[model samples]
Target chain A: MDKLKAIIESLLFASDAPLTIDKIKSILETEDRKTINNLLVSLTNEYDSQKRGFFLSEVAGGYQLRTRPEHRHWTRKIRLMKPARLSRPALETLAIIAYKQPVLRSDIEHLRGVDSGGTLHTLLARGIIRVLGRKDLPGRPVVYGTSKRFLELFDLRDLNSLPTLKDLQDLGQEWPNDSK
Target chain B: MKEQLKNKSESPYEVQLGETFEGPMDLLLHLVKKNEVDIYDIPVAMIMEQYMEYLKLMRIMNIDVAGNFLVMAATLAQIKSRMLLPVDEEQEEDEEDPRMELVRPLEEYLQIKYAAEDLAVRNRLDWDVFTRNVSEDTEACEKQDQEFVNISLFELIDAFQKIVKRVSSKHFMDITVDTISVNARISEVADLLEQHDSVSFQELLEGQDTKGQLIVTFLAILEMAKSQIIRIMQHVESGIIRIFNG
Candidate 1:
C-alpha cells in the first residue's frame, strides 16, 4: 500500500496536467478502478492530514496537484492570472445556455434581442460552452450547451446541481407555498 | 438619478443610461422589476411606450441602441395594435395572449440573468478552492508570445490526418490489416527520414493509403516526433508539415 501510494504520487508529480482515474490505472497497469480510486482518496487525506504545501485536487475532470489557497498570495505576487475572464455579456450568454441547453443561437439572440456572435465565440474559445449539434429547424442553426469543463469551473458536482429559478427564489430561504 | 439628470437637461429626449453593458433585455427586465409587474401579465402597451421612451434617452445619450431593441419595439407596437381590437368570443376561447410573445422571453431572460449573477458569486467562491497549475503560464510576463516548444498530441494528430488523407485516396482496396505495429512503423518512418534531409508529411505515407495503414503510419509519425527522432515543422501558418531528421 505504501509503495502503491508512492508510485501514484510520483506519477502525479511527473505529470504536467491532471490525470484521470483511467489514465492513472492505465499507467499503473491496474485493473479495478476502485482500488486506484481509494488510493487517490487516501493520498488526498494523507496530504490534508500532513498539511502539505500542495494537495491533489480533482480539477478539469482529472486529478492534479495544486498549491494551497493560503499560499496563493505568494504566487499572485509573482504573477496575477485570472484565466477565463467572463465579461458581463459572456456571463449572461452562459447563463442562458445553462438554463436552456441545446438551445438554438437564433433563440438566444431572440431572448436577448441582440447579436451574440462575438459572445458565443468567446465562450467557445474559453471551452466553457460548445456546439452540441445543429437544431432540426430552418437552416439547421447551431445549438449550444455547457461543457464538462463548465461543471468543473463552477465547482458543481453535476448539471443537476445548477441553480433553477426556484433555487434563485428560495435563496431567501422561503417556505414552499401551500395555499397556491 | 437619470430622472434628475433628465430634468436638468431641460430636454425630453435626453436620458442617462447607468452603464454600457446593459443589454436590451437587461433594460426591459429592470423596468419590469421596478414596476413590480407580474412577468406573466406584462402590460405590453405601457411597457412598450416606456421602453420606447427609454430608447429616446438612450439615443440622446449617444448609446448605441442595437437593432434588437428596435425589433422589440416593433414587436411591442404589433402587440399593442393586436390588443387595441376586441377578439371574437369564439376566437378568444383558444387564442393566445398578445403579450405572451414578449412576456415569455422576458421571464426566461430575467431567470438566466439572475442565475448568471448567482454563478458569478459561485465562481468567486470557486477561485478560493485552487488547483495545481503545472503550466507555469504566469511564471513569466503575462503578455509574452507563446513559446511553441511542445505541440499538443491533437495538433500532431491533425497534421497526421492531413497526410493520411492525401494517401488514402491512392490505395482504396486495403482495409483489413492482419499485422502492423506502431513501433514497426516508427522504425519505417525513421528509415524514410534517414534517406532525406527533410520530407514533406505526404512523402512519409507515399504508398500507404488504407485506413489501417493510415492509422499505423499516423501512430508511427507521432511516436517518432515524441521520441525526438524527427521534427515536424510547418514552413508557414496553416501550411503543409515538413518532417526533418532529428
Candidate 2:
C-alpha cells in the first residue's frame, strides 16, 4: 500500500497535466484498473483529510493536482494568469455550437445572420468546440460539436445538462414584457 | 427618408423601443414582435420603411450596420415589389410568398440566438470557477520555437518511460556501480545540444548501451529543459518530441 501511494504521488507530481488512471496503469504495468482508481480516490481523500495546499481535481477528463481555491490569494501573486474572458460574440457562437451541434459553419452563419469564422477560431483554440466531421452535403462543409472539454469548462455533467430553450423561455415568462 | 424619420412617433413602428440588436435579422425580429405582426404575414411595405429608418438611425450613431443589413433591405424591397404585382385570378395560391425565404431563416436564427444567450449566461458562471496553475504554459517559448517542432511534455514523459522500460527489460541487472552524476550527465547532454541547435529525443539517446546510461541521459534532458537551457518541442499533430537549444 505504501509502495502504491508513493508511486502514485511521484507520477502525479511529475505529470504536467491531468492524467487518467489508464495512463498511470499503462506506465506502472498494473492490470488492476479498479485498484489504481481506488488508490487515487484514497489519495484524494487523504489530501482532503490532511488539509493540504493542493487537492486532486478530476477535470478535462483526467485527474490533476490543483491548488485549493481558498489559497488562490497567495497563488495569484505569482500566477500572472490572464482572466480567460470570452467576448459576447464568442459566447453567442459557443451557444449555437452547443445547441445545434454537428451543425455546419454555413448553418451557424445563416442562423446568426453573420459570418462566424473568427468566433469559431477562438472557440477551437480554447478546445471548447471541435470539428466533428464534414457534413455529407454540397461542398461537404465541416461539422462542429461541443467537446468533453466543453462540458468540463461549463460545469455541466453532460450534454443532457445543457439548459434547453424551453427552460430559457420559462425564465422569459417572468419578464413583464413577454408579449407572446 | 428624413420625412418618415421625423414622423416615426406617429406610427406604430417603435419596435421594442429600447433593445440593442446584434444584427439586421435581430432588428427585424424585434420590429415584427413590437407591432404584433405575424411573421408569416408581414406587412412588407410598412416593415421595409420602418427598417430603413432604423438603419438610418444606426448610421447616424456610427453603429456600422454590416452588409447583411443592406442585403435584407434589398430583399424586403424585392418582396414589397412582388406584393405590388397584381395577383393573377387563376392559381394564385400556388405561387409562394416572397417573404417566406426571409421569415423561415429569421425564425431559425432567432431560436439559435436564444440558445446563444443562455450559453453566454453559463460563460459568466464559468468565470467564478477557478482552475489550478499546476502546469506552466510554454506560450512565450512557443513563438521562438515556431521554427522547431512542437511536442507536449506528456508525450515526452511517455516516450521516456517507454525507453526506460525497454532498456531495463533488455538487462535485468540492478547494477548501480558506475552511474554518471546527474551534473556530469547534464554537461555531456549540453555539449551534444551545442553541436546541433535541435535534436530529436531518440537521437540524443542513440548508441547508449546500458540501462544506467539511458536513464541518466533522459534525466539530463529533463534537467536541461527545467533549467531553460533547452525547450522540449512537441509536434502539434504527431506528438513527437524534439529538443531546441535556448
Candidate 3:
C-alpha cells in the first residue's frame, strides 16, 4: 500500500497535464479502485498538513497537481527570472480577451473602443492568447481564447475562477456588469 | 518619546501607506514626491537610497516585492553612478539630454499608468451599456437555445471509427467483384425494402466481406438519398431507417 501510494504520488507530480483515474489504473495495472481513492485522499491530507507549495485538485475530469495560489508570486518570479511589465493597452486587451474568450478580434476591438489588431498580434506572438477556431459566419473571423500559459501566469484554476465584474467593482473599478 | 523617535528613525523607510503603488515607476514617483525633489532633476542618489530602504522594509515585513522593483533599484544605481562620472567631450556632444533620457522613462511610465486608470474607468461604465444592448439583441436570436449545447465533431468521428472497427473485427470471407456497381447495390436494397415494406438496418449492413466495403456502400446510399434518388422513411423515436425506391 505504501509503495502503491508512492507510485501514485510520483505519477501525479510528474504529469504536466491532468491524469484520469482510469488512465492511472491502466498504467499501474491495478484493479483496486477503492485503494486508489483512499490513497488519493490520504495524499491530499498529507500535503494539506505539511503546507506544501503544491496541492492536488480535480479539474477537467482529471486530477492535477498544481502550485498553490499563495506560492504563485514566488514561483512566477523564479520561472520568469524577472517581472514583465505589461502596457496599458496590452493589459486592457488581455482583460477583455480573458473575460470574453472564444471571441473574435473584431468583437474585442468593438468592446475596447480602439484598434486592437496590433495588440492581438503581439499577444498571439507572446503565446498569452491563441486562435481557438474560425467562426462559421460570412467573414469567418478567427476566434481567440486565453492559453494554458495565461492561466499559469495569472494563477487561475480556470476561466470560471476569474474575478467577476462585481469582484472588480468591489476592488474599486466603477460600474459592474457580468457581460460575458 | 526619545526612544520611540529612535525606533522610528531606525525604521525610516517603514511602509505606512498601502502596498499598492501601481508599478515600480509609481513607487519611484512617490519616493520623489516624498523627498520634494523636482521630477526633471531627480536626485538619483537619494532616490536610489530610499528605494533600497523601501525594498529592505518590504523584505523585513515579509512582503514579496516583485522583480520589477528590484530592477528599478539596479537602474537607479546605474544612473546615479553614471551621473557621478565626469563626461568626456565625445559623450557630452551627443544630441540627447542625459536628464531627459532618464526622465523619458518616467514620463512614459506615468502616461501608461494614467492610460490604464482611464481604461479601467471606461470598462466599468461601458460594460453595463454593452450588456443591456447585447441582452436586447440576443432576445430575438432564440436559436441559441440549441446552439449552446456541446456537440464535438471529434465525438461523431470517434463513433464512426468505433462502428468501423467493430465491423472489421467480425470474421468474414473476402469477395472479389469485377463489376459490382454501387448503383446496383442501392437499387437492390431499395427493391428489397419495397418488397418487405420494412427491413432492419442491421440486416442491410450484414453480408459485407470488409468494413471498408460496408462503409463505402453506406455512404453511396446516403449520397443517393441526399440527391433524392431514394426516399428514406424512419420512426421518430427509433433512429431506424427504411429506404424506398423512388
Candidate 4:
C-alpha cells in the first residue's frame, strides 16, 4: 500500500497538469477507486504533516502538486516562465462573460458600459474565452463562453466552483466604496 | 484640481486614460459614493450636473473622452429634462421612475465588478502556485528549449489579415485569378513538409503572387490543421509560427 502511494505521488509529480483518480487508475491498471482514494488521502496528509515544500492541490477536477505560497520568493528565483497577468478592465470583462455566458458582445458592452472589442479580442487570442457559435437572433452576433483553459488558469474544478455572486455581493457590502 | 492638472506636463488624455478611468458608469458610481447618496433614490440632478462638469473639464483640458461618455451625458440630460416636467397624475400610476433606467444598469455593473474583484484574489494558476511541469509526450521532444502555445483560430486570422494586407500592398497589379485550387495547395504544402522538417508560416506564402493564391493557401493550411495533417505552433517568446508534420 505504501509503495502504491509512492507510485501515485510519482505519477502526480511527472504529469504536466492535474491527474484525475480515473486517469491514475487507468494508468495503474486497476479498478479499485477506493484504494486509490485512500492512497491519495494518506499522501495528502503525509505532505501536510511533514510541512513539505509542496502539497497536492485539487484543481480543475484533478490532483496537482503545487509549491507553497510561502516559498514563492525562492520559487521566483528558478521560475522560467514569464508571470501572466490580466488588467483590471480585462478581468471585469472576463468576469461578466464567465458569469453570464453564451453572452453576446453587445451584452458584455452594456454591462461593462464600455466598448469591449479590444479586450474581447485579447481574451480570444489568449484562448480564455471561446466563440460559442452565433446566436439565433438577428445579425447572428458571435456569442462567447469561458473555455476549459479559463477554468485551468483560474484553478477551478469546474464552473460551479466559482464563488457565488451573493457571496461577492455580501463581501462588497462590507467594504466602503470610497476608493474613486 | 487646477494645481494637480498644472503639475502634470503630459497631455490630459494620457493622464486620465490609465486604469483609473474605467468608463462613464464608473465615473457615475464614483460621484454616487462621493456624495454618499442612496442608489435607489439617487440625486440625479446633482449627479448629472457633476457628471457633465467632469465632461466639461475633460473637454476644456482636451481629453479624448470616449463616445460612451457623451452618450451617458445625453442620457443624463434626457433624464433631467424628464424630471423637470410636471408629473401627470393619471400616467404616474402606470409609469416607472426614469432614474430606474440608470439605477438598474448601475446595480448590475456593481454586482459584476464585485465578482471581478473576487476572481482577482482566487488561487490563480501561475500567480499563486507553481505546478510541477514535465513533458508528458515523448515523441515530440526535439524542440525542448522553448515552449509553444497552440496557435488559436483568431491568431491565425490575424496573421492571415496581415498577409492579405502585405499581398495587396505589394502585388498592386495582380488580378483576382484562381490560379491554384485549395486541394492543389494542400498537396503542395504536404509535399513541402515531406522535404523539410518544419517550415515557417511566412516561408509557405513566399512564392504566392496573386490574392487568390494567398487565400487558397491559407484555406489549405486551415483545412490541413483541422484534419491534423500539420500542427501550428507559435513560439512563446518570439510568437513566430511554424508548421510541423503531424
Candidate 5:
C-alpha cells in the first residue's frame, strides 16, 4: 500500500501535466483497472480531507495537483515573480475579447454596451490583443484577437482548451443570487 | 532701387516658376504672420511667390516634393492670377474662393494636434503609476511561482490527443479477441526484458504494423516503464528507445 502510494506520488510529480487512472493502470504492473481507480479516489480524498495547500483536480480530462485558490496570491508571488492587477474594465474587456475573439471593436461595444475604442487601443498597446484583420465593411474596421501572451497568462495550451459555454453557465450558478 | 528690385525678381525664386512648396499652407501662414496680413484676406501673389521660392530651395537640396504640394501650388497661382483679372458683374458670379475648402481641414488638424498633446500628458502620468504597480506585482508573482506548481491537466490531454490523432490517421489492423492485446503483449515483453539486461527495440517491434505498430509498441514500452520492470534509453533527437531490464 505504501509502495502504491509512493508510486502514485512519484508518477504525479514526474508527469509533465496530469495523469488519468487508465494511464496509471497502463503504467503499473497490475492488470486491475478497478484497483488503480480506487487508489486514485482514495488519494484524492486524503488530499482534500487533509486540507492541504495543494489539491488534486480533474481538469481538461485528467487529474492534476494544483495550489488552492486561497494560497494563489502567495504562491503566485513566490513562483511567477509578479501579480499584475488588471483594472476592472481591462478584465471585462479581456474576457470579452478572449471569448469572442476575431471580433471587431463594434461587436465588443455592442456586447459591452459602451464605447470600447479606447479600451481596445489600450489592450492593443499592452500586447494582450492584436488586430487580426480589417472587416469587409464600409469603414473596414479592424478585427481583434487574443495574443499568445493571453494563453501564457491563462495557462491554456490553445483556444480549444477553453471550457464550453455550458460549463461556464453552470459555474455561474454557484454564485449567490444578488437580487434584493 | 528699381534695378535692385528687378535683380531680386530675377533671383532663383522667380526662375523656379510654378514650383510648389512642400508645406504650402504652413509657408502661406508664415508669410501672413511675417507681413501681419489677415488670414481671411491672404495676399495670394506674394504668398505664391514666396511658396515657389521655398520649393526651389527644396529642389536644389534634391528633396522630392509630393504631388499634393505641386497641386496646391498650382491652385494658389491660379487663384492669385485670377484675383489680378478685373471681374465683370456676370463673371463675379463664377468666382469662388479656393481657400474656403482648406479652412475646415486645417481647423480639424489643429483640433487633432491639441487632443494628441493632452493624451500624451495623460499617458505619461499613467505610465508612472503603471511602473510602480509592475514592481509590486513582480514581487507577488515571485511568491506565487515558488508556492504553486501551476500545472494544467489540459496540456496532458492535448498531448494524448495529438498521439491519438497521429495513430488514427495511419492504416493498421485492429487488435481483435483472437489477436493478442497490446496490454498483454507489453506484459510479456516486460517479463522478457526483466530477465535480459537489454533487447533491440526494432526486434521487439518486428511483425507489427508498419506505422501504427511503432506507436503501440512505444505505448507498451511506456507501460513497462511505469512498472519499473524495464527501462528505455535514447539519444537526443533519436526516435529509437533501447529497452533494458530494470
Candidate 6:
C-alpha cells in the first residue's frame, strides 16, 4: 500500500471511533481532501477484496473498520460484550425522534396515543436521544432529537439513511409520504 | 361487577396483554390487521365496541389502563357519533372525513413501527461487529466496574428518611431545644471537610442526639450542595453518598 493509504489505515485502526476525511487530512498535514478520500476508498476496497475478517463501514458521517457480522461468534469468545439493549417502546420513541425531530414530547405521545415519558427517559439514558431545547409553546416542553451515537448504533451514514416510508411497504400497508 | 372491581390485583391475562401491547394505538393497529380492514375506511362502531370490550377486560383483570387509552376511547366514541349524523351538503367538499383524524395518526404510527424494526436489525457496534479498540476495551471495562454517579435529590432525601427513622425511634418523647442551627451545622461540615478529604453522609450524621439536629445537618448539606461548596457522589456498588470539597 502507498504511504497515505497505510497512514489512513493506521489511523482508523488506532482510533476508537470513526475517522472522517477531514480528520485524516489534518493529521496528514495536507489540505487535499480529495486525495485523502480517494486513498480511503482504495483502502476500503482493498480490504473488501482481500476478504479480511473486518470491513470498512461508512457510519455516523465517517469511515470505520468494523469486524464482519459473521465473525461475531468467534470474536465474542475472546471477551464479554454487553450489548446495549433497547426495548420496543424505546425503539419506537427513537424512531419518532429520528424522523420528526426536534419534536415535542406531546407530538410523540400524540402519535403513539400513549404516555412516552418512561420510554423517552430510557432513550435519553442510553445516550441515543438528546434534549435539543424547550419548545416555544406553552409550558415550554422539552424538544428532542437523535444523537451521533444513534447513527453509530444504527449503522446509518446519516439521518437521511433512515428507511423511508416507502421501505415500510413490505412490513404493511403503503401510504403517501405527505408528513411535514 | 362489584366483586371484580373491589379486588385490585393483576390477573395473568393482564400481564399477557401488557406485554403484547405497547399502547392503545398498537392495540388498534393489531385489531385492524386482525380484521383485514383497510386503513382509509374503518368500521368505527364495530371497532369502538371491541375497543370498549378490551377496556372492560382490563378493568376486570384489574389492570389500570392509562388515561391515554381512555382518551382514545372517548375520541372513538366522538367519531362514531359524528359518523351517525347527516352529511352536510354545503361543506362536503372541504370538510374532511372524521375518520381521517384516526387514520392519519395510525398510518404514521405504522410507518414508524416498521422503521423501528428496521433499526433493530441493523449492525450494532458491539453486538454484531467488533473494532480494534484493545486499549479502549480495558478502559471501558474499568469504567463499568467502578462508576460513580452524581447523587440526585431523591437519593439525598432517601438518606435523610433513613436517618430520621433511625433517630426518631430512640428520641420519640425527648423535647430538645433547637440549639444546633443550620448555620452552625454548615460551619461544622466545612470544618470536617477541611480536616478530611471526604465524608460519607451516614458518617456526617453519626452522633446526632436529636431529630432537630439531624434535620439541621441535612438542610446544611443541601445548602452547601446548592452553593457548589460540596459535591455529592455515590458509588454504584456501595450506594453511599460521599461529600467532597468542591
User: Whose lDDT is greatest here?
Assistant: 4
Report the C-alpha lDDT of model 3 over A1-180, residue by residue, as the tens digit.
899999999889777556678888999998888888888889888888999776776544566666665654344333312223234456656777777678898776544434567778877877778999999998898999988746544444567866564445446422221111
lDDT of 6 at A28: 86
**Clashes within 3 Å, all models in order:** 2, 5, 0, 0, 28, 0
Positional deviation of residue A14's Cα in model 4 after best superposition, in angstroms: 0.4
Residue-level lDDT of model 5, residues A1-180, one tens digit each, is 868977987787667555767788788867887777777778788888999776665543456565665654444344434334343335446666777778988676544334556667766776668899998999898999988645434444456776644455444432211110
Query: Candidate 6 docking category?
Result: acceptable
Candidate 4 has what TM-score?
0.66
Number of colliding residue pairs in model 5: 28
Cα lDDT of all candidates, in order? 0.64, 0.65, 0.54, 0.73, 0.51, 0.72
Instruction: List the pairs of residues colliding in candidate 3.
Output: none
lDDT at residue A180 of model 3 (Cα atoms): 14
Candidate 2 structure quality by residue, lDDT tens digits, B34-142? 5678778999988899889777754432234678888999999999998889888796889888789778886566555566556644522123234443222112222
- Give candidate 5's TM-score: 0.29
TM-score of structure candidate 3: 0.36
TM match of model 6 to true structure? 0.67
lDDT of 1 by residue, B89-180 (tens): 88898888988888777767666666777676663312444554523211233322122122333235446556656654546453443435
Residue-wise C-alpha lDDT for candidate 4, range A24-138, written one tens digit per residue: 9999999999999999889889889999998888777888898887776666556555344465667888999999998999999889787788789878988889999998998
Over B1-246, each residue of candidate 6 has an lDDT whose tens digit, in order, gives: 334223222212222223213568876775676577897899999888977877775554334577778888998999999998988899889888899989988878888877776777787777677777632212121112125555544346557667767765566334344446566789999999999877899988867766545655776787677565777778778887888875
Total backbone collisions, model 1: 2
Residue pairs with backbone overlap in model 4:
none
Give the candidates in order of lDDT, highest first: 4, 6, 2, 1, 3, 5
Winner by DockQ: 6
Tens digit per residue, CA lDDT, model 3, B144-210: 1111122111222233344556775544234333323455667777677668754544556655555
Candidate with the larger lDDT of 1 and 6: 6
* Per-residue error (Å), model 5, residue B216: 71
Candidate 2, pairs of clashing residues: B150-B234, B150-B235, B151-B233, B151-B234, B151-B235
Distance from true position, residue A42, model 3, in Å? 3.3
Q: Is candidate 3 or candidate 5 better by lDDT?
A: 3
Task: Please report, as a residue range, the 10-residue window in candidate 5 chain A with the lowest summed lDDT.
Answer: A171-180
